[model samples]
Target: MSTSPQKRKADDLDIELDLDEYVPYVPIKQRREAKFQKLASQRNIPEPQKENEPDDETEELVRAGPKANISLIDQAVEVKKQKLIEDSSKTDIEKKLEEEKAIMEAVAQRKLLASVQELAKGIIYTEPMKTTWRPPRHIRERAQADHDAIRQRYHILVEGEDTPPPIKHFRDMKFPSAILKYLKYKGIHRPTPIQVQGLPVVLAGRDMIGIAFTGSGKTLAFSLPLVMFALEEECKFPLIRGEGPIGMIVCPSRELARQTYEGISSMIDFLVRDGYPKLRHLLCIGGISMSDQQNVLSEGIHIVVATPGRLMDMLEKKKFNLDLCKYLCLDEADRMIDMGFEDDVRNIMSYFTSQRQTLLYSATMPKKIQDFARSALVKPVIVNVGRAGAANLDVIQEVEYVKQEAKIVYLLECLQKTPPPVLIFAENKNDVDDIHEYLLVKGVEAVAIHGGKSQEEREFAIRAFKEYKKDVLVASDVASKGLDFPDIQHVINYDMPKEIENYVHRIGRTGRSGKTGVATTFINMNCSEQILLDLKHLLREAKQRVPPVLEALEDPTEKFKDLSGGCMFCGGLGHRISECPKLDAQRRQQLGNISRGGGGAERGGGEY
Candidate 1:
């Protein structure tokens, strides 16, 4: 008998099992028994004597001795069998478990769909079309006259030395043909409208805040000009052989930094071939082993794309020189603030010299962000792609007043009707997990991403979502930031956010660049008056169609309370674990009553 005890597992290594799609073969036990019996029969050497067989040592020895051969047969298994055993020692079995679990998930998804379909048939009603009275010819003429007069007032195109010349062609900028060639290889020969308008302004060393929807090739909009500016500076300072990193791009999230780097990798690679071999790009984000990052930084870099917090930590540790950085791009301007990185961003900005060219881009610009931009940039050449009182006309906004209990029903309907690769945003961490489970149960392919997950888990989830291994992506605010997932065609807000700012960021995930898309939100009793008001304010700002019913719940008070827990009703979360009501209540009760109770409260009462 073996006396050795099994090794324990580490707690942080989240182990999960999935038995979905489990095409199980017969147990190894069956094989063991069959092989043992076959060997016994072969070794028996039957004696064909009549009557009763004599009880002899031969028979006794035969049974026991034959069993010894079974061990040898076990060794005859394939190399793959041995490899699986060996590999198990290095990796946790949780990954395989997850795969198996997916089979169950598929079943659950189907059930969810069926139930949702039934509910959808009842709740989804056709909205009646509004009939408006026709306008008179005089009214139409008056409107045209007013439009012309407003255009004339704003059309006073003053000729100033600071104003950049209108762009005619990409070649006019004179970027190295090698870089241009690389851009062409990536099928990005044409610069975006923002790139055409923003590049010239950025290249002029002017600060700029460009508001454009997602997927408009904003990375190139900021990067191409920054690269050109740096290249020009290098030519002027030829004597200084090795100047440290000249440009830095600060994003709000790791995924964004990663995507941004990929977006500009070929262009940077082309620079390396042009003999400015010192041209090196660095990436810094959470969840990565920092040893290699530190080692690479010791030698220095020409460009660094990083999330704000990690970048701040690297700076405090003096990882590299930042005094020379002359270019900065806040790639996801709105997300940085929404992700609570505004402070980190401001701190990073302080490190760079005021002369650095600053560029900020976001789908929506709020007052807080405007204030930040005003302070951060010089008299910036503000380029607004946004129309007055219009919020991404390309995106269709929808809201559903779903019953609190009928969310699952509504969710199923949305999933079935929505196009594939839809992004579903939840307000809390648990909701991400729960919805991910529900979708899997309903037979819809899906995955979840949150801070609770490790780096590897997050990467795998995104890959599955992007590669169509999954149809829906269930995520918390973690997905709301600078991250980019190109295949996402629809965005569903399962829960409304507390801040109007957050709502803007959430919707911005879709209709990126110039692509048309749709955003749908859940509004019900769970949606508080404050949330409703915030939505109305946003709608008014965007000049969207607002129903008369929306005006009924005019929130008289600002209610961003930073509640102790996510509202159990809506699942909206914005606070830390310590602040949770359930946890707090448990702690309070535990502290109030001693485990021993009054049985030990004898002599001195409660006084010590």
Candidate 2:
């Protein structure tokens, strides 16, 4: 709307009032004109007056400058050159990666040097472990050569893709520092064949079936990996009793379970240092208070070393759960089957998750064990340290053909031959008690253990034997397998074992850890004929001297041959019919008759 001059002045005054907080309202064209006017005034230059031209249609717009001629390719090339110059400089990320690599290499060198120093000081077993970070050609070649030698020596047979090389020494493996220290403290320098081979597979997170001799350190092989796995899991998730153990080791016998628990617990204790968490382990076995075990479970355990029956009992009672279990190890799996723990093991396995790792270790791989492995393990690698059913080669076996009644006498003779620390294995508890009592009466220090004995008594007997307080430990098949007695110089088989595997395990009680030992068996007709052929084959394979009595049993017809043929009355083998007990009795009667006739003739006739 048109306004008077006075009204426009009033509007301008209103617009100029308090412009500090005012939002700009003037349009761009008017602002630019005012800016030009202010600039001309500041520079004291005359303003270019707008020309008073009539509104004509023909008005020309003027250009400020001319455009330069340029091609797209040259412009792109120039831009690329600048980009290359910028890229030639190192970025912050690249610098950081280089620093990290150097730091890692330095750490590796320090670790290697520490290992070598320990070896030099006779702390750890063997030399420093070869480093894979910057492996030299010579180092790799030497490692390969050592691995081949170990394989050849142990007769190791492996079946798996990407099977790691066997460890020659404990240091060759990447165990936690706690384990190495424990080994050093225990004077275990070299890794046994089973430990060397089986540990790598288990540590690599693969299911494995390990076959090795009884005393070949299979326990530690599985235990070490189990500790590492539990530690790794504990770091990821907090342990709770309701979730059960992250790792579980099932053994056949209570002794084996306790032994395994002790081994694992010692290492776990060592692992609980400044920066590491405390690892809790429980031994769930029979003959112990169930309430006590329940208390342990309530507190929570990272690992559970259990016997099949006891583990099943715990499961049934809802004492623990296995749905979150990550590792399942069956030590002496074949023995477990023989002990009839297959059903319990399977039932316990049902509680575990399907994604668990399984490890089955046995001295001998029987058909039952093989079947179980096929069902339980997922593409397991079989690691055979030696031939199945083969006895320890270091035992010097000698058989004596004695009557079953004379076993005690023969045992005394064996004691005379060897020094202290003798293990006497009998067939039954009665025989063990009898022998133990006889030895005690003979002023010989002895102890006895059988399945019938209370657990406390058995443990006491074992302790006595281990401490050298008792020179002789008479036992049944209960101590035949998985008991480690390092100082046993002789194993006397007072009563031959019924099973061939039991016989092997009985003799295996000696000649452990590459030490030479003597095993003497007293054979009678009852057991000799039955086990003669098997014994002969075993002795021959072990490079032992087979007695002629056993060698004679090689004939298939001799399976029923009686080796104890002798006189039934006098128990003598070389006697004629005329000299038998019946003939002697008749002769004595005739002599009596003659004596009586002489006496009557002298008394009645007086002169004859």
Best by TM-score: 2
Residue pairs clashing in model 2 are: none
Candidate 2 lDDT over 42-148, as tens digits, reads 99844444567533231211111123244556667867988778667967445444554553344223112112233345442222211122223443466666867
Local accuracy by lDDT, each model: 0.61, 0.70
lDDT of 2: 0.70
Point to the candidate with the largest lDDT: 2
Task: List the candidate 1 regions with Cα displacement exceeding 4 Å.
Answer: 1-161, 182-189, 232-243, 270-278, 334-343, 387-390, 537-608
Worst 10 residues of 1 by lDDT: 599-608
Cα lDDT of candidate 1 equals 0.61
The residue-by-residue lDDT of candidate 1 on 246-319, one tens digit each, is: 78888766667777777667676777787654445678788887786664566656678887777888788877
Model 1, residue 305: C-alpha shift (Å): 0.8
